[model samples]
Target: MEDTQVRDTIRSNIANKKHTSDKVMPGFFLLMASISVLTTLGIVIILVTDASKFFSAVPLKEVFSTQLAPLRETPSFGMLPLISGTLMTTLIAMLVAVPIGLAAAIFLSQFASDKLRRLLKPLMEIL
Candidate 1:
């Protein structure tokens, strides 16, 4: 029958596709993954080399100084400002994001209908 022939054709197509996937997909993925891994390893190696050179020239104690003075002949370095700035930025981001995220979660849970929540949940999750 025509239906049996169609079924045979479908099976044949799937069988051929399976062969390609079995042989090709893993090798393609491995090549792509190797490229990414090698790139990251190279970057890390370069950073470590540069950092070692810098630390050897500048003593670790100076880098951790509490006071900064760029006016003098030998300028003082204080890393406290950098650390404080990082803390401040984190605090500000949390202050803004936490309330907004909490409000969105509350709104989704309490106010939104199931259908609306279903639509919005995925969109919010993407964000």
Candidate 2:
């Protein structure tokens, strides 16, 4: 009888403590979400503004003109060399990353025990 009364009292307390939307309201959360979104949009606008200024200062002729051999008069844009360098670097990075990433994933999945796997899964997700 005492245990039953104790359980009944605990249940009543929990029922009384139940949260209702009427208490705190939802508008506060909605306002915070809107502020976060607006801040992100403002950052994007600032970055685009800075990039446009940089592009505007450089002459299009220098970027788009053709290269010429020695003693030639043709206007030359050296952008192609820069573009090729960037592509080569990107390819090298991807080549190195793909094999290493695959190896790490295979090691984790195939070699780890269940307890280690559970711990590592969350750690990887956090990263």
Candidate 3:
């Protein structure tokens, strides 16, 4: 009888408990998300405004010109080399990383025991 009464009391308490954390958590997350978005926008606005000022002061032709200037002269600002380098590095990184990442994921999911998988998954993510 005591066990039955205690179980009933516990069930009632569980059912009656207000999920206040659920209500508060979304507000906290939304606040954090808004802060991040606002910060990004602020940075982008500063960059664009500064860039506009720079572009206005400097000649467009000078920026895009192909001839590499002599020492003691302003270096050519042609974007091709920088852009190509970025693309090449991106391609190389993807080629190397994608296969390794996929293989690790496959190994973790298929070969590892549940406890080992749980342990390794978080470690891999942190790395």
Against the hidden reference, what TM-scores do the models get? 0.78, 0.49, 0.58
RMSD (Å) per prediction: 3.7, 7.6, 6.5
Error of 2 at 8 (Å): 16
lDDT of 2 by residue, 1-127 (tens): 9999999999987776665544455677878999999999999999999978856875676665445233456534447667777899999999998897787678789998889888887876574
Candidate 1 yields a Cα-based lDDT of 0.93
The TM-score obtained by model 1 is 0.78
Candidate topping lDDT: 1
Go through the candidates in order and give each one's C-alpha lDDT. 0.93, 0.76, 0.84
Q: Give the winner by TM-score: 2 or 3.
A: 3
Which 10 successive residues of model 2 have the least lDDT summed?
68-77
Can you rank all candidates by lDDT, best first? 1, 3, 2
RMSD of model 3 against the true structure: 6.5
lDDT winner between 1 and 2, please give it: 1
lDDT of 1 by residue, 59-115 (tens): 889888887786889987778888998999999999999999999999999999999
Q: Candidate 2 — what's its lDDT? A: 0.76
